[model samples]
Target: MPPAVRERISAVTQKGVTLKDVAAAAQVSRATAARALNSYGYVGGETARRVLEAADRLGYRGNRIAEALRRGQLPLVGFVPGDIQNPFFARIAHDLEVELRKQRHNLLIASSEEDVEQEKELLDSLRSLSIRGFIVAPASATDNRHIAELAVGNVPLVLVDRAVKDVQCDSVVVDNEGGAREAVDYLVANGHRRIALLRDDSRIFTAQERLAGYQNSLREHGIALDESLVSISRSTVEHAVEATIRQFSRRDRPTALFTVDSLMTQGALLALRSMGLSIPHDVSLVGFDDFNLATFTDPQITVVAQPISEIGPLAAKLLLDRLAGNRPAIRNIRFPTRLVVRGSVLHPRKS
Candidate 1:
């Protein structure tokens, strides 16, 4: 390290640098130094620059909590997603962090783990931090009073990948119902009557919409809804494996399996393999939210592909717009999903 830099750091550690010292160095008043450092009231361009330089030189580390309290908000945007381990949310997080940082704001991410109580708790905790805003993929579609309260309280918030019933706010999601319907329609078109669905909890908005699509598609084709063929599991591989096993243990097993998310799809693949079932022969498969493993699998999985790359960046933009005080009206953008066909399906007789 350079000599001056080392000396400045040592001075801070030994005696602690004060705002007065920084003000004296910059030839400004203490009030001006505070303003420049905390970013509350405006300061002149040249004076603000000098004050920041002097603060850096003296290694003056202000109390962040105190500053946030004074300013009524922090330079941070909290993100609460359904699951952090899911790559769909991971990609969105990366984009959110990048975009927030561009505006001199930091990202604070907390996963709700697909639990309504946890989602409520996380939002409460983040609000206590005086977070400038939030971007969330809520855990429940119906039980979302915590999220609704935030919107009603005029908190700057954006919902991504899901929207609640009464919480009106800016959102960025996809046509989950349409995508799911298409996947099932394709399966039915290929002459498959005994198709099964592996899905997430009913509370989640995406799961609800996708489930509707599944039911609607079957009904449109004059096929009766067999409640036995639908299995519910958490959005995790282990839970999905268990669900898949239970679903297939019946003597009249499903001819095809449609999994809602990539994690569940991966679990289904494992469970099927463990049972000595072969793809496109023993049981054809389709999944939602394509992942790296989707294309790599043998007879690469057919999937309802959401515009993953578009979702995160678009959500970030919407949240940023809200933070920028440009709220003419609430914007709710829902992108369309497409079916990405591969070699994962076969005729009913083959199954």
Candidate 2:
């Protein structure tokens, strides 16, 4: 550790060191010392070094929350996710917290549990706590009135994973459409014509985009769109399992299944297992959003992997830029997805 941080740690019981003392020791005004400490305003290099040395010798430690309040700002950043149960969102949240901590800011996380009203209430509660900005994955694309209000109020906000239709703001999202298309295209190349899609409700933006990509790929490959092969509004594992079972029980069952999200993918696997259907023997499978459990399955699942590691850091950088007074036009950054082919997908068996 540097001398300043080391001295701070050593001075556990000493409490008299202050900015005034540091300024006096450095032979500079309190304003100059403050600027040097915070790196807010322009200060001469030598002057900053001297002030830092004085602070280190005196063991002067600043209270970040108190300083932020004095400057009419909050040192807290808010992160609101639609559901924390999803490992994808949890990973994003964890990465975001790590990035925020590096910038000397505290992260406050709240879950909406995939409820629109609950999301609004959580936003309201976080706003009341004087959050500096927000990073959100919207629960419903159509019902984003609260998010719109945040933009209107000039609060720095960044959308992650999901983007609302009318609520324009900075966003960092994966290429859901392209990923879905790639997965479906891979299935088609494996000689699977009858491909079934299992997805969440269209209220969520990611689900909608993935569904569009699935449909578009089928159309591009000269496969007539079959509405009966698509399963929508399957939000939970139980719902997805039921939908998958119902679809497979049909006289004209699909040869392959493409799930739009992790939960639905797990459910589809369970449903296939319960029906005694073998992977790529009875039905090939492709899923969106790679997770740890995907690799541990009997035959590792093939999935469209989003850049989870980059998403959170990119979102944090956007918010931090806005906080630093960079008011450029809103930007929508869509990261590309990759298809990791494992042992799951294979050529369809002849009838």
Q: Identify the leading candidate in terms of TM-score.
A: 1
Q: 58-116 in candidate 1: lDDT tens per residue? A: 77888876777556666888999999999999999998888888888889999999988
**In model 2, which regions exceed 4 Å deviation?**
1-73
Candidate 1 residue-wise lDDT at 14: 68
Q: What TM-score do all the candidates reach, one by one?
A: 0.84, 0.79
Candidate 1: which stretches are off by over 4 Å?
1-60
Global lDDT of model 2: 0.89
Error of 1 at 204 (Å): 0.5
Which whole-number lDDT from 0 to 100 does residue 187 have in model 2? 97
Alpha carbon lDDT of each predicted model:
0.89, 0.89
Clashing pairs in 1: none
TM-score of 1: 0.84
What is the C-alpha lDDT profile of model 2 across 1-351, one tens digit per residue? 357545554554266777877777777899999999997899999999989988887777887776765564767889999888888988999999999889888888899888889999999988876788999999998988899999888889999999888887999998999999999999999999999999887889998899989999999999998999988745667888999999999988999999988988888999999999999788999999998889999899999999899999999999999888899899999999999999998898887
Positional deviation of residue 19's Cα in model 1 after best superposition, in angstroms: 11
